[model samples]
Target: MGVTRLVSRRRQDPGTKWARIAMAVLATVGVIDTGSITLKRWGFLGELTCPMGADGCDKVLNSSWGTLINGIPLSLVGLIAYISILLMTLMPLLPGLQENKADLSRRTWWGLFTLSTSMAAFSAVLLGLAVLKIQAFCFFCVLSASLSILLLVLSIVGGGWEDSGILAFRGVLLATVVLLGSLIWISAVDSGRSANVGEKVGVPPAVTNESSIAALALAEHLAVGGAVMYSAYWCPHCHEQKELFGKQASQQLIVVECATDGQNNQADLCRSKRLEGFPSWEINGEIDSGVKPLSILADLSGYQGSREF
Candidate 1:
């Protein structure tokens, strides 16, 4: 009876159960963090209310450094990582998968260690980019990095390793491969949008008249609603926002140039409004930061225009 009880206990160790729970919780937080960023970047969600300044968040997220593989947002990759971690951590907890739990424990722990360490390594690279390359303070990025570190610590502590040296060696080797693989992937697939040291911000391609009528009408509605576009002449995003309006319609916008020497400059007013990010839209005294689509602008201004953008 004691031996049977011991075998039953080994089948579902209470300690490992707790560890998986902790990891799943952290991974879920990571998912929300990266998932929100991905949605916002894709324009499906409005701008994030970053705890750090909205301008700082926008600058970092929209910067060339944010792209990883062929214009894919780095947040998307992070989203995948977090989801994978969540799924893997939960796998052994399912009733059906519990049959070989003890047998899989060692391998599972090492596998998790490898994944967590890889994430930590990638997070380290991102932290460096946020500090050195982006030179922007992003609260979300920092939070994700903190989560990665915490997850790594949890993995190491929960692994229940028999040999410290073996664990360390495996961790180092796995981390190195992940880091190098990421570097190679980035180099081979980079979109060539790296912020050039002295290059002028390229103008957005002009919008053709073939653009939907709703988009053109939305621009007019924004103007009629006393909407203002606070922008900088050197801001690529500002140009892109203008291009969305097409030529004739864009002419109707009350565009305020925040650059001191820019045409129709309103640098003082922009400063007074505390404008930091380019292409910010102001409607009914509410400022929406970042490049927003015509549909969003229309909805914000309560325009009953056609939905097509």
Candidate 2:
């Protein structure tokens, strides 16, 4: 009777229900945050009105670190993580799980702790990259990191664990593993550091992709229409924009090197134009920033030869 009563009392102890509620709310916001970025990257949505300006967001998001090995947007990974956290937070509250609520709650709390720890660790890695390597301020990235840290904190405060030592051990182990894995993945995909070593100091990477006939025609048409691409040698998005045109087509386009140290630089003209971001396009005497799809560029340049690009 004593043992049974002890078990019952322990089970009935009121956990921090408020913390779970807060976690759910935060996770929902995270879902929307990451989801919007994913949609924009996939071209399902138009340009995002980032706080401060679009330049930082564009630089960070179009960098080589922005996508996974398979070319999927990194924001999609955050979206999936947020959705999983949301489901875990709300699952034990369902009416069907009421009979096993105590046990389910215990297990889910552990799951939340592990998952949130991994997220927070990985977020730290990304933050380091944004600060030290990418050297850009990404509002969405900062928001996601904040959310992950908060989720980890909530998991700890609300778990009501009996063994602090065990919790500490698990957290340390998981974080170390996550940090190591994140570093390895980042090093593998960082083209700025690895692939451009032999090139001149201020030269951009060579365009490796082949141009389609449609792409070639579009490029010629853009050149004939007096379209100009303004870019800095260090800008990843500029390289990305060139890659879209492929090697042959990219050579045909009028590319002005805006960086003072870049080869064949036109710094004075770029300053005269008051350029705000890399890879800005001057089409029909109108300046626009960010990387444009080939089809959009074709339209902007009044290219009638090829809609296939």
**Against the hidden reference, what TM-scores do the models get?**
0.67, 0.79
Q: Pick the candidate with the highest lDDT.
A: 2
lDDT of 1 by residue, 115-157 (tens): 7899898888767766775566789988888888888887777
Poorest stretch of ten by lDDT in candidate 1: 1-10
Model 1: runs farther than 4 Å from truth?
Answer: 1-13, 69-71, 181-191, 194-228, 232-239, 242-278, 281-309
Using alpha carbons, what is the TM-score of model 1?
0.67
Question: 57 in model 1: Cα distance from truth in Å?
Answer: 1.4
After aligning candidate 1 to the native by TM-score, how far in Å is the CA of 118 from where it should be? 1.2
Residue 285 in candidate 1, Cα distance off native in Å: 8.4
RMSD of each: 7.2, 4.9
